[model samples]
Target: MRTGERRPTLADVAAEAGVSVALVSIVMREAPGASAATRQRVLEVARRLDYQPDSRARLLRSGESRLLGVVFSVRHPFHDDLLTGLYDAADKQGYELTLSAVTPRRDERTAIAGLLQDRCAALILLGPLAPTAELATLADRLPVVVMTRAVRHRAVDVVRTDDSRGLQLAVDHLVELGHRRIAHVDGARWVASADRRQGYRDAMRRHGLEEFVRIIPGGSGEEDGARAARLLLDDPPTAVAVFNDLAATGLLDVLRRHNLDVPGDISVVGYDDSSFSALAHIDLTTVAQDIDTMATLAVSRAVERVAGAQVVHRETVIAPRMVIRGTTGPPR
Candidate 1:
């Protein structure tokens, strides 16, 4: 093949192997019509020419793409972990994943549109920001599974950790460690924010520490955590429950810079035991959302819907567990 030339096609393989294009197609698909010897010869010739099948075209022709479109944010560390789990789960179920990222420049609409253009069989959106009405409209078109967020619509299926319960676990853990003055670094108005915030409040009330319940306005990123840390310095709580691992890491950084010893001086707990949280250096005490279970269930749901199965549930809420690490202790 000449440099910069187009890749070899099925026709090229057929011509070289002295077989009809139809025979080549049968061999390529490993269909029953092709004899074993013919299949072996055609495959060998195709290998010699470095011929690669176009999966998209093949799936399109077969009318079963088996493509699960995942819309995730590029910024979240937990999203990366979720993607890894989704890939494994999808592969197990004989499905492929098409990822569309919601970057700073690209909006959710654009990312979702790209997936639609690729003819994805179902959509598995990670922490989607779209409204319920919008999601309902999308569900009407195709099977939609919203992950890491709660939405109630007959058409939409949701698979998410119980955010409120997750936060309650964080607060309870902190309190059990003898932390009376507990502050929450909140993800203001973001998906799952309200539930976490409410969990914090409810846990505080349950512990009879309502007066110590202070919510510092924050967000889902490290910068937001840093900003909240700066505010906490003036009237620091005995312990803090951060929104997620990313924000918790930021808060940890700021606290270290200010010579504050974690747990010793100010115990810190974060939600989402993401891969980063388990790092040797971070060892963040966090709420563990079973990513593997969620991913597997999401794929199963998407596949079942794609195969025209009747799905009764609109939402699947997974329970969150608390992973205690080096970050939490009895506050000084």
Candidate 2:
């Protein structure tokens, strides 16, 4: 090869290995027809020539992308965990993943459009905020699976945690700890916000603590939690059930800044049980969503749809568990 030579191709690899291009293709795809010694020799020559198979060209030839597009929010820690699980699940099913993040500058619509442009075989949305009508329209274009949100759409399959049960567990834990004045920091516009908020109300009523039910305006971010914490300080509750772990951590920081002792002056319970919640210093008592199970189910459903399986468009809800840690105790 000369200086600054063109990148090696499959033909170059075949010529160097004294094999036909057809054999080279078989070796590149790891197809079963090639003998073991011949496959190894071809692979060795390809490696020596720095030859790489063009995945895009192969996908185009097969008319199947085998791509599972994932849309996730960059700000959510739970989304990061879910992404890792999704990758493992997708790989098990012989599919590759293309991720589009919903950042502060990029909205969900833009991220989804980019995935569509990439010709993803199917989409797995992580806690999408798009309207039901919009999702149905997108589903018409390609198979869509919604994760971490419960919605009934004729064209969409859903895989989500039992959010109502999750919040119920949080309130139940606080009630068991003898905390009567329990408030909720709500994720006002989040995907699971309404369900969790209603669950908080229902759980309070179930325990005959409806009279003490309070909900502060919040969302799925630290700033929202900080704002809710300020409101709580005006008339603090003995314990608070936060929207999610990210918001809970913010509230925890604010409470610390105000010299309020957690699980002493005011106990705290968060939802989602994200990675940050398990930190030694955080140790947030929260509701745990089964991320691995949800991810696996989501990928399976998406792959089934992509493969033209005759499956019903149904919602698969997994139960949430309660994790007790340093954050919650009996109310002062």
Candidate 3:
């Protein structure tokens, strides 16, 4: 070696540690087969030589891209909050998340297949629209954790709210306020929406007040709520339980335009206690879902699959609490 020149190599580290070049190579690249003592010795020798492994080579050998694929349906603002929770949890668990939105143009199957080709360990689908049979088929190859959807497949884990109970809470609140002539603004197309709508109907029947209930043609947004409100201009109910906070905001807007008093001349309830639900001006009564817990549990379940654990077909249903605000009162 020249006195003024210096270049580090695996052979140099092997000579310094009294080990073979093969052993030094394993330690330098952090391969799985090295013994702890041998690894420590090789690491010490490399530190003396100031050796750094090639990151590109390391990634190729590990077969891990260190990325988790996350798919969202419709990209609602509430989903943005859930994404924040998911990202924070993923970071703490030492995984990076790649996001893709499923739209009318880009279908779910194509987007998910692209993610799999990129070597993502698992896929998290939020409020998926795919058929249950299709999801079960996908689970045969890779790990799948669904948020806001239910499945009984052995390969899928579900984290969701008790949609039935949430709706019952809404109905019970209005019923307690003497609201017999109540109505429901339903988001009927989604799976969760169907459950909530059924729960509303079931609760109404239990209270023997089904005769007075009205079913409004609505959806999951403020525009749908506004349209439903317009339809109610001629024959308004004493109170209404909207599909979500966005719809409730729209209902409030239409009611304000028509000079109807909230919870006085009419009461209103909404689901999903989103940030917009608590504005100083809005002050909406809503059902609160634990976003942080759901996100954390979802990631943990994904990790269990990645670890080769014998996971069961698990479905978790967390009950929602009703957040009573100024939007509800005794029916007039």
Highest lDDT scorer:
1
Kindly indicate the candidate among 1 and 2 with the higher lDDT: 1
- State model 2's lDDT: 0.92
Instruction: State the lDDT of candidate 2 residue by residue for 147-258, as single tens digits.
Output: 9998787689999998999999999999999999999999998889999999999999999998999999999999899889999997889999999999998899999999
Arranged by TM-score with the best first, the candidates are: 1, 2, 3
Q: Per-residue lDDT tens digits of candidate 3, residues 1-332?
A: 34686777778888999999888887766678889999998898788778766543445467865567898856365777789889998888887787887776988888788778767777888888888889989888888899987777766789998988898999999999888888999986865888888889998999999897688988877898999999988999998998888888999999989999997888999988888889989999998888999899888888788888876648888788899999999976
- Give the worst 10-residue stretch by lDDT in candidate 1: 55-64
Task: Find the number of clashing residue pairs for candidate 1.
Answer: 0
Each prediction's Cα lDDT score?
0.93, 0.92, 0.84
Candidate 1 residue lDDT tens string, 160-263: 99999999999989888888999999998788999999999999999999888899999999999999999999888889999999999999999999999987
Better of 1 and 2 by TM-score: 1
Off by over 4 Å in 1: 1-6
Q: For model 2, what is the alpha-carbon lDDT of residue 221?
A: 91
Comparing 1 and 3 on lDDT, the stronger one? 1
Best TM-score among the predictions, by candidate number: 1
Return the lDDT, model 1, position 283: 93
The alpha-carbon root-mean-square deviation between model 2 and the true structure, to one decimal in Å, is 2.8
Q: What is the lDDT of candidate 1?
A: 0.93
